[model samples]
Target: MYVFSAQRRAISIICIYMTYPYTTWQNCVYSIDRR
Candidate 1:
């Protein structure tokens, strides 16, 4: 049970981080396109 919860938390954190990376990548692309 403890292992399952730990995996869930890790997955959640990974998902959040992945989203953040994608957003930053998109923002960078937009800025470059604007220029």
Candidate 2:
């Protein structure tokens, strides 16, 4: 159970980094530029 919890924590951290706020900010900029 401890190992599974650790694995899930690692995966969550990875997912957070993969779709980080900076990437979303860049997408927002592109949309603003289109205006």
Mind giving the per-residue lDDT tens digits that candidate 1 earns over 1-35?
13436655565555567667566544543454466
lDDT of 2 by residue, 1-35 (tens): 13446655565556557657655534543454466
What lDDT score is found at residue 19 in candidate 1?
65
Q: By summed lDDT, which 10 consecutive residues of candidate 1 come out lowest?
A: 24-33
Q: Candidate 2: lDDT over CA atoms?
A: 0.53
Candidate 1 TM-score, C-alpha based: 0.41
Displacement of residue 25 (Cα, Å) in model 2 is 16
RMSD of 2: 12.5
